[model samples]
Target chain A: MKIQVLFGTESGNAEIAAEDLAESIRNDNQEVEVHDLSSFSIAELQHDSLYVFLCSTYGEGELPNTALPFYADLSVVRPDLSGVRYAMFGLGDTFYKDTYGQGATKLDDKLTELGAQRTGEIGRYDASSWEPVGEGAVVWFAGVLEGVSATR
Target chain B: MDAPLSIAVIGSGPSGCYIAQSLRKALPQSEITIYDRLASPFGLVRYGVAADHQSTKSIQAQFSRLFERENVRFAGNIEVGRDISLAQLRSTHHIVVLAAGLSADRAMEVPGEGLPEVYRAGRLTRLFNAHPLEPTGVPTFGKSVAIIGGGNVSIDVLRLLIKQPEDFANSDIDDAMLAEYGQAPVSRVDLICRSTIANAPSDPVMLAELGRIRGVRFSCSDPIEVAEDAPRTALARAKAIGELLEVDPGPETRAEVVLHFGWAPVSINGDGHVRDVELRSVNDDRTNQRLGADSVVTAIGFDFDGGDWHGLGALKADSETGVLDQGLYRTGWIKRGSRGTIAENRSCAKTVADEIIADLDSLEQQSKPGYAGLPEEVRALAVDYAAWKRVDCAEKEAASEARTRRKFPSHEQMVAIAHNKLVESSAAQRGN
Candidate 1:
């Protein structure tokens, strides 16, 4: 299966997480490519690859600088994503309380509204927590990968 | 076409890496080599950043890419002054950037500071991060601990000391050291701050995070007063502290963190180790108090010894710009003192890079050997990126199931792992 690791970041944390996920996928002898969400056009949703979105929340739970363009593109274009499957991992600080992980939640909601199928739970990491966002995301995605294989 | 010059950047920290990045973009064909005393790169990001804040440390992934470029290289385990003189590097490279960060801890300058249980925040941070130079042993902070500072670093030390084992899941913290620290549970932590609640330097987010920790009580010496006309930052900070003070730890509370505003450390008093800290009010009231503490950690700041490191009696660089001699330059903490975040270092490096380009571009410059000009023994001692990757992998592979990675705390162990040498045992490698 072709896996696309899409990332949106403010401080490059999401990008690094996406790269780490891609590296892990490759280690498992799977084909994967990583891309910045800012550079990914909404039209590319027509592709049959499984998408894994790793995004971070910026100020007041808003989408990160890089993810904003992609989110806007998806909202306006509203491409048919009936056949698209995705998984989400969000980076946020619980210190923000009200808006924590809202960026990823908004993106996830948008995808589902567009008839896209999401596999596994939407993983969330709190910056205030002791665990690293990347480490937690990797652990969560491992379960998602297992589920994908089982469904296959 | 841009001038193809030889550039050597000392210290592979954020400033050095950013300097290399900016220089690479300006002069694509130029040779760039970043040098560090440790076997690994990402100086402070790897050693000074809190282990739990791996997201912040992930900036290293971007820096690692710079080393993969043919034009830029990393020379680890090489000190410019000790291994090869600054004069030799200047003779070899067109421009030499000194990004060697301030490593020395600024002394508290109070009596009884030389006690055994008193540790500098930098030293403790390094120990927890598993910096190769730090001694291989877990610190014992006993039941009561006193931290001197109101900065984010003081909060980081407090968090490290108080976090439970389960809280450390998936973190790359020194698990063995953490386990040892956990042996003697810290019941109380006093944060002695010279600034009031409104003026405290710690970030509001950090203060709020402390409120969320389970089984901990938080209190402030001075009540937070949020003024309607105050600055937005001050208001936010006051709100965060107010919220922290509202946290009800209840009877189940295992620990308490007290914030003492407008208090300056007069002395750290003890017979042999840290037994108590004496503090005097910074206000005109001039009241003094003695708080009993088993351990005292100071998170004040860091300093650089310009006299010993740089060959010049004192580095006579331009205060605004980092220009010293014609070919010699400086950046990061060495240039601007111990201030600015990692992001600020990026801009500082860019400014220095711009100056270097403008200075060397118009002039007819002679070619010089950059990395090739370093001593053969020094080059041999240096660990390349590939070898460093082996050490990185080994660290991860050796980690327990719950941890992301377990760092080798000694230079010998890291060097052995990097070189694929057969070390008898971890204990033997650490000479314990």
Candidate 2:
């Protein structure tokens, strides 16, 4: 299967996490493609493609600046993604209590509403803890790997 | 048009590196060259932060990777306002980012503020951290010291002064400065704030982390008086402080930190060196009190060193985008003022990078020679990444015997080392 990694970020944290995850999965001999959410094609939400969304919440738990277009289009177009399977990880600060990880949750909800099945639980990393997203993504990939195997 | 774009970043600090990192992602075909006035890179990481915070300095590991990129280069010892001109930068490179940071130290207009013993946080940090630009080897601050601010910089200064020399064994502190500070008569540091504790701008973690350092005792005066329109971040900080109050100081204390809230420095009273400061309460002016201290550090904050007097004055930084004007842009301190964590510069630089990426279509077509086109005088003086590595190796080598990481500690010596006149492993005589 061709794995797709999409990142949404204001500070490039999500993108770094995606790139690290994509490289690690590739080293395991799997084919992976990494993309910025702004450039990612929604039409690619088809069957037999594995997906991982690395996203960051900004501005009171809102979507990243570049991720807005994707969110708007995906929500409005509401593409049929019944065959799509994906996992998500969000970068947020706990100091932002009300909006913590809301961006990723919103996207996950929209994707699920569009008939996509999540491969595993969403991961949330806090800035106050000073956790580098790349470090968290590596551990989150294991659950994603299990989900992919079971579905296949 | 050539798909690859050439970029010039004026300052090799986190702000510059973050822009380079974002540009590599936003525009893959871009080539980034970082320039600094000093022979070293990683501006504040190398020279601004207190030396005791070694782990904080490790952020260089990530920045170092940016320099190794095939399309990236670090050019040091090149002054923009003097060695090169802003007009020259704009003519040669597609984008010019002024990440030089807030270079000027903001001093108060109060009387006697410029006394020999009084220092600003910016220059003091550079001096303690061993930046080549620091004027002298050791600044005299006899016995008691008073920092007139409640921010993290004040806290950092407090820790640097109160900590023992052995505490910096694994750090990159200047050996000479550390030894001087070690011998200084400094024993008590008073943090004078204009508002209550909650109103102070420093992170609560700063207050709680005192447990890690032995011999330092911290005592604050009342909770912060939360303002009606106090931002959410500050309110959150107050909540964090509520949590930090739970930590208890362990035994083996030596130095003491006394915090005076709701007090402002009215004037400095000193004949030659600092002797005393007259502090006035925030709510009332008549409530004047005098405190004795040999040294006073104005750890208030920093302002943009806008060289507007030069006609090419820098523009004000935008809240959302860092576009100063037309083709010229900015990031980091000069753009946003000296605030926010080091990591926050990533987002600030990313915003500036995105603006540049969007304007790429309208940018002037690729020019020949790029950085090589710099005037021969400036080009000859530029120190590339390889020379910086040698300087690094030399600094480490010099400190090897003391088992501490020492630095060139002076601009003249660093430039001399880059010119190959100073041996890497041997003690190079000080001065240019």
Candidate 3:
């Protein structure tokens, strides 16, 4: 399966996670492409392939600076992701008073709203606990693969 | 081997958290302790971000998870210079990450900067964030408010002054701050930009947000000259111009807050108090404008406040590259002047981290110690891992009870809570 990994990071953590995930997938003989969400256009979401979004929510549940324009575009109009299978891993803190992980949750909801099938349970990683890195991420990805395989 | 190298990270802000997380991922065996002058982690994320923008603040939850790592510890409410010294840190931790951010605002260089009403946007932001220094009383907005500068800071201040609770209630602003903001008689917020709209650093999101304001009108005209005698008129001219010129100042627009672009402040006209601000056109074309407002906020920018390490020869920074004398590492606003969004800081930080890692192999061969050995002063203040976690929990509980996000009103509160929690946990462990 051709897997495309897209990530948005404010301080590079999400990018690092995305890269690590892509590397792990590649090691398993799966073709993986990783792109920064800032560089990735909304149109690319329509590609006929499996997708994984590893995005970091920034100031006040907003998208990272690089992913803002794309987010803005998505917010206004829904894009078709009919056959695309996807999973979202959002990096955020729940400590903030407002809606915590609101940004990532918004994206996940929007993607699903546009008819994309969620391949796995949405992974919401809290940096406060540091439990979501390494093995945690690996296990989440494994579950996604299993789901995708079953669906196929 | 050898009890995994101990690393202490100072500041616990975004940069500090990122560094700690990266180090943990790179070397899981190493022990990491994140420290901050405040009792809570995530420095600016807790305070600097505007209250209405709760979405941005949500990122702090991610940092909290990083602290929960097996080998990572969070220490809050411990001032590095005061509680501990740089020399002390070197004795304990193998590596010390100084992610301390800029603590001071860049001066406007105008005479009336010391006036009561003239505030720094950074300071104002901290106040609204309920930072330790936030004044107790409502700020006197008078009839007009002139905010100098065209950056994100300026935009935020303008938003706060104009939008009121009806605009911000849905956002994450704290109750106390929102109540105070709602009571303030801030009819107009004039955003002063030294350059054209194209050159201004104000975010487009802010501009779009500003456009939505009902009672506030944004003007982009040259400020009127302030005469020695007619101090009030000079300030009122922008308002007057806004009322007459704006064909459609939007539906909620009433009080004119003229946004003056292309003017550099020359002086503040007053001896003891701020009465008027004398401004000159940037071209030195002799065109003058005097802005009369009760309060003036210089939102120019922020600058790094190098702590006790300022005069240390060991921390000497190269004039050109901004690298430290040891050359093992460098950093964000301190290394490359304050500018750029968080996204930009990522690339800069990555470059610095990469350079430090690249030299690690060569330095190990030469028997030179990496940043593992911090100065003694920093190590002294390092709180135990469990203590920091308690402080983090206390802040969360406090924020939740207040129906607001996490906020530690004072540094002392954080320290006390953390210390108590440490004691409680120790007692429980002993009983077990």
Candidate 4:
């Protein structure tokens, strides 16, 4: 199955995380492509590929600069994603308790509301943790991949 | 048609890197070189952000890619005004942008500020981050420390001093310095701010971290008012401070932190080292409290050192456009004074890049040699990106099991490592 690792970042952590996950997928002999959500079109959400959204929350739970246009297009166009299976991981600091990981949550909600099915549990990598994001992201995606395969 | 754009950016800090990133996107064929006096890149990320905040420092991975871009180079260990004159750089490059950030800490100017126990926030922070310029002496903070500013920097000091050794797992904090300071642990911290809680400039998220520090008791003299109509940030700050104030350290309490609002330092009292601090309430005419302190650290702010090597220190940029003069530019903390976060610098850089692009679009083409045009001796002094990478690898290789990397605390050591002289020096030491 083709996997799309889409990332939106303000300070580039999410992008780095997406790249790490893509490399991990490749190491497992799987095909993957990395996409920056800034230029990604809402209409590109197809049922054939599994989408993994890696997004970091900017100030007060807002989408990162690169993800803003994508999220806006998704909200306005409200594309039907009936057969789309997606996983999500948010990069955030737990110190921001109220708005922590809300960027990924917002995208997850929008996709679910538009009839897309989510696979496995939503993953999170806390910036406050001592664990490095690259390592933590790869570990999170392993579970996500297992769940996707089991569902298949 | 036009000569390929040649740009030289002074300082490899966030602002400089962001400017280079934007300019690379807009003018991919341009010659761009970022210079720093230190033999390293990512100025504050490598040295200013608290060592424990490794997540924030991870932004270097993005900036690191910028140094590897085609036609872009990093000229480390090169000081613009000292190694190569501003006039020389101008003659060599089509444009130069000064992002050399403010260097001097704004002095408290109170009597006894020069006491041995008194330190500036910038120096202390740099010291912990193992900045080569900062003295590596383990600062003595005997039991009580009084921080004289309300910014995030002050909180950073408080966190560093209060955190246990275990809290720094995988962090690149200077272990030797931390161990020496840990010998005489600071048990009390008095955070003094001239403004009210609502007006303190520290982010609420930063202040909120205080509540999470294990085994610390917090108290506030000023009432934390979360007014219904207060601004969201102010309200959040008040709530955080209020929550911290309610924390009960219990029987196993490790330390105590007291927050003082609406108070200004009158004097630091000590003969040689700090003994106590004198403070006055802004509302009252009478001189008020004297808290016994082992040391006093000021985090008021920063200002440029009087030597304006960048030649744009006059703040003469067109306020609306950010253009100083033809072929001259400024950005980052140096451009707008010492303020703003790294994220803000990215936007500021984009704006300046836009300005530079528009300005260059109108100018006539002229052949300009960028880094290659510099004198052989000056260029020889630079530790290029690859050499600096060697230093980086050496630092990581030298780390203990707990730390991510052990930074060279002196310029000599880093230079030696970068130039592959460490092996020879170690062999010499062994012979001795």
User: Per-candidate RMSD vs. true structure?
Assistant: 7.3, 5.7, 9.4, 4.8
- Sorted by DockQ, highest first, which candidate order results? 4, 2, 3, 1
TM-scores of all predicted structures: 0.75, 0.78, 0.70, 0.83
Displacement of residue B122 (Cα, Å) in model 3 is 1.6
Best by TM-score: 4
- Please, what are the lDDT tens digits per residue for candidate 3 over residues B1-432? 244556667777776776676667667876677777765677777778787666556566556667654456776645767666655664565556567767678888877788878878887788777775455555776767778888888888877777756666434455576676676567766677886443456554455555555655555565444444543323343333334345456566556767766777887766676677888887558669787776788888876554446345433222234235342244655566556665554566566666555544443222223233544544444455566667666655666433454556655555556667454553353242
Per-prediction DockQ comes to: 0.12, 0.16, 0.15, 0.30
Tell me, by lDDT, which candidate is best: 4
Q: Candidate 4 lDDT, tens digit per residue, B1-432? A: 366778999999898998988888898888899999998999998999999888778778768878764456999888877788988998989988888877788898999999988988999889889898886787788889999999888899889988889988889999888888888899999999998777887888788877877889999977776568877678888888888988777688899999998899999998787999999998667568998999988999887777444565545222455577788888888777666567778878878998998898555467888899999988877888999999999899999988989998877667667767765673353242
Best by DockQ: 4
- Model 1 clash pairs are none
Candidate 4 chain B, poorest ten consecutive residues by summed lDDT: B312-321
Give the range where candidate 2 chain A is weakest over 10 consecutive residues by summed lDDT: A126-135
Model 2 / residue B326 / CA error / Å:
3.8
The sequence of per-residue lDDT tens digits that candidate 1 reaches over residues A28-116 is: 89899988898898888745798999988865467876778888887898888898999999888664786688889989999999999
Model 1 score (lDDT): 0.82
Q: Can you give the lDDT of residue A81 in candidate 4?
A: 87
Interface RMSD of 2: 6.1
Instruction: Report the TM-score of chain B alone for all candidates.
Output: 0.93, 0.88, 0.79, 0.92
Please give the fraction of native interface contacts (Cα pairs under 8 Å between A and B) kept by each candidate: 0.12, 0.09, 0.18, 0.32
Off by over 4 Å in 2: A1-14, A27-152, B2-4, B223-252, B283-286, B304-310, B314-321, B366-368, B397-404, B412-432
lDDT rank order: 4, 1, 2, 3
- In CAPRI terms, where does candidate 1 land? incorrect
